[model samples]
Target: MPLSEHEQRMLEQMERALYAEDPKFATALEGSGLRTYTRRRVYQAVAGIVVGIALLMTGVIVPNVLWVSVVGFLVMLGCTLLAVTGWRKAPKPGEQPVSGSAGGSAHGRNRQRRSMMNRIEERWQRRRDEQGH
Candidate 1:
């Protein structure tokens, strides 16, 4: 079931409270932070790619070592790919969840999660109301 507006507000409030009470734990649960590509990291990646190319060349020149050259080439390709697009920006620990592009898979996933959360929240609200009565 979808959450009513009041219930959504309540949930958001609870989330804020949880974040306030245990920011460290909340951050940890948010998962690893994005790896910012620094100048040093770029340099290292370039060095690794160069080494891989050198190894590949050596393997190609050496008799009976075509496999070594293949491995080196694969390593070079992997490094290049990683350098180009290894990581994306993870959502900041305390920031609101970002909605994905309209009608995307991410939207679907978020919708499913929201509905499940609403079900849980409804149960909680029912118990609260019962206790108050």
Candidate 2:
């Protein structure tokens, strides 16, 4: 959902205050560099895999060029590894739901769902109170 004007203004004010207090820390929190690096790495890996496929096909078509296919296979393997590692290392954005102490069991999920529902109910109640007032 989009932020209300008042909420947006408050958020902007808080952001300005944060910037004034600690510009470097706020900038570091942006995290664009890590995202960009991960994207670039994945793209490069995909390109490498495509090139490897072409090489493999070429080697197979040509007689007595087994080395090309072997090299292509190795390249594909390396690129696959690179892509997997890059994706794994990338940080997930947004708030993650807290799991219960018992790990991610059905009970944990139920609790989380109930908490979210309670929050929604509280918000609805507050809105009703405000409208009534």
Best candidate, TM-score = 2
Per-residue lDDT of model 2, residues 7-112, tens digit only:
9999999999988999887776666766776788889999999999998998999999989999999999999999997776554442232333435555756998
Query: Candidate 1: RMSD over Cα atoms?
Result: 15.4
Error of 1 at 39 (Å): 1.7
Work out the TM-score per prediction.
Answer: 0.38, 0.50
lDDT of 1 by residue, 37-81 (tens): 334356666887998999899898999999889888988888777
Off by over 4 Å in 2: 1-14, 88-133
Superposition error at 46 for model 2 (Å): 1.8
Residue runs of model 1 more than 4 Å from their true location after superposition: 1-36, 87-133
Worst 10 residues of 2 by lDDT: 93-102
Alpha carbon lDDT of each predicted model: 0.72, 0.82
How far residue 24's Cα lies from its native spot in candidate 2, in Å, is 1.9
